[model samples]
Target: MKNKVTAALIASAMLGCLGTGVYAGSNLQEIKAYLNPGIKFKVDGQPVQLTNSSGAVITPIVYDNNTYLPVRSISNLLGVTVNFDGKSNTVELGEQTEGVSIAKGFDSSYHTKDPKVTIYNGKDYKDVFFDNGSGTRGSSFMLYPEGKYQKLYIQIAAIGEDLKEFTIQDSDTDTVLKKQDVRVEDGLVTIEADISGVKALYVHGDAKSGGSVFIPLTTSYYK
Candidate 1:
């Protein structure tokens, strides 16, 4: 007696859980759902725990003989990122254009050397990197694409009340691929670079008044 559930319904439920007022539609219907706490999940024959982003445990929901799982939890189990764009009312799975996070393939050697490089999450952004200011110039970091990605899409902005300049350069040739100056008031500036055939990238930021630079993780993707 498995029954198909609409994405709208799932989204509605998620929003309700989040205490958001957004509704999927006016034709919403209510159904009795039972929480099955005894159920377990496994991936590739290995057991896995189900939890939301808050680390709260989640269980399968049984409704009309059909089982439903939290989309975010299931996506996380499969090594996928789930994002909801409230403005567009859409759910995005994985990176846009079949891309992955530059953070995923970050060079580990620089981790100890560059303490200013940090992964950050905020109310407006998720899984992003913040280049905390260093000296008169802003912070910088390196990422290894390994020639697997053809394009890189990112949003950059000044973190605090200051203006900042950003540059993306080819690590091998030191060739500047893209440069932009962003202000905190201007918001996140989108940058698209043709990273075709490039192996490594050096991202640099220079601030006017010693402020940090922001690069979103969920929105930035390499394809």
Candidate 2:
């Protein structure tokens, strides 16, 4: 069953369905459950369910090596309308009604110390790289994401040396989302958080050996 599901998604990828990947589970049953017509979602901390007129469920699938959320499902969750014209094979999403900034990575203006935006091998979007200053120096990024979003996916890691400590926080609410006491080892360390009602995100980096941290953030949202 798992193999079947993986094959189906891989096929979709071949057909050029591209978007962010939203994995609820790894098994086929879980994937199916995620697609159930009665599946519930949270938008700005509000619960909402999706329904189809034909009794079919909409699901997110891996396409073009990315997870593509169902247009209908995301639209309903974000309170945006969707229109599809089968004749022209076109899908239209309504303009964003709410003020939200959703993107694959952070822009230069959002960084505090001017982190370099670079691309890694086998990665699609650009990622920010921050170096912990030497001799009692530190760096941080202050990100203000207004409006609603489902998740915040971040890939952070140390360059050569392990990161002694790091912190992720919701600056608007003054709530710390994650604070790592142990070292963030070399290689990619991905973290996903539910940022539904979060107004702002702050990332602080501290290291003993002065290493770099990669932040390839991908924010999910409705239309």
Candidate 3:
């Protein structure tokens, strides 16, 4: 009976020692190394949409209070083309060129002689031609491009402090591409439109006393 009690005590002591080692605090420094949550990204004051390797859209995650963005998406948004070679696992980024300026490259005609490139809101603008005609009559402007362009970036705003309605149309087909009423109180109004296969664009405004101003920003097309 005495030998049996001694064996039982030894077993209980071994179990206590093993339990202490098993329940010991883990190394928090080592654990923190693996905890990378993620960052955020934006383009042109807009949040960038992320896509995974399988071409599925994913949302960005925040890690350590920093925003992370997908490199490919941000690069593309900034006008850099990304190409991947799967066979050799190589990636290529195309060169970015200076975009063509629409205001300098195209010819414009307007009825009002007040429309001229001048300093407005601390920047030079080929300002809009005004139509002060009675009975809410709108004015129009014509632009003739020397070459074809796929995209057109324009900044338009009201002449006064009020909102103004403006429309863009394909002069050849007379198809309305976009129409919107914009106010310039906050900042300069801006838009990016796909003007593919369009030779000429007609900018028109709603029947109003003060005309909406149009400023051509940039044009992009393949060579």
- lDDT of all predictions, in order shown? 0.63, 0.48, 0.47
Model 1: lDDT of residue 55? 85
* Model 1's TM-score against the true structure: 0.47
Off by over 4 Å in 2: 1-127, 181-186, 217-223
- Candidate 3, residues 1-223, lDDT tens digits: the string is 1232233333333221111112334432421212233444454567765554356664543345543444344333443333344444433333213345554544445322243544356655443433434455565676654223445666655555444557778898898877777665745666655554466888777655443454433322221
TM-score leader:
1
Q: What order do candidates take by TM-score, descending?
A: 1, 3, 2
TM-score of every candidate relative to the true structure = 0.47, 0.43, 0.43
The lDDT ranking, best first, is 1, 2, 3
lDDT of each residue in 202-221, candidate 1, tens digit only: 98767655577677666777
Q: Of the candidates numbered 1 and 2, which has the greater TM-score value?
A: 1
Ten-residue region with minimum lDDT total, candidate 2: 14-23
- Pull out the clashing pairs in model 3: 39-67, 39-68, 40-67, 40-68
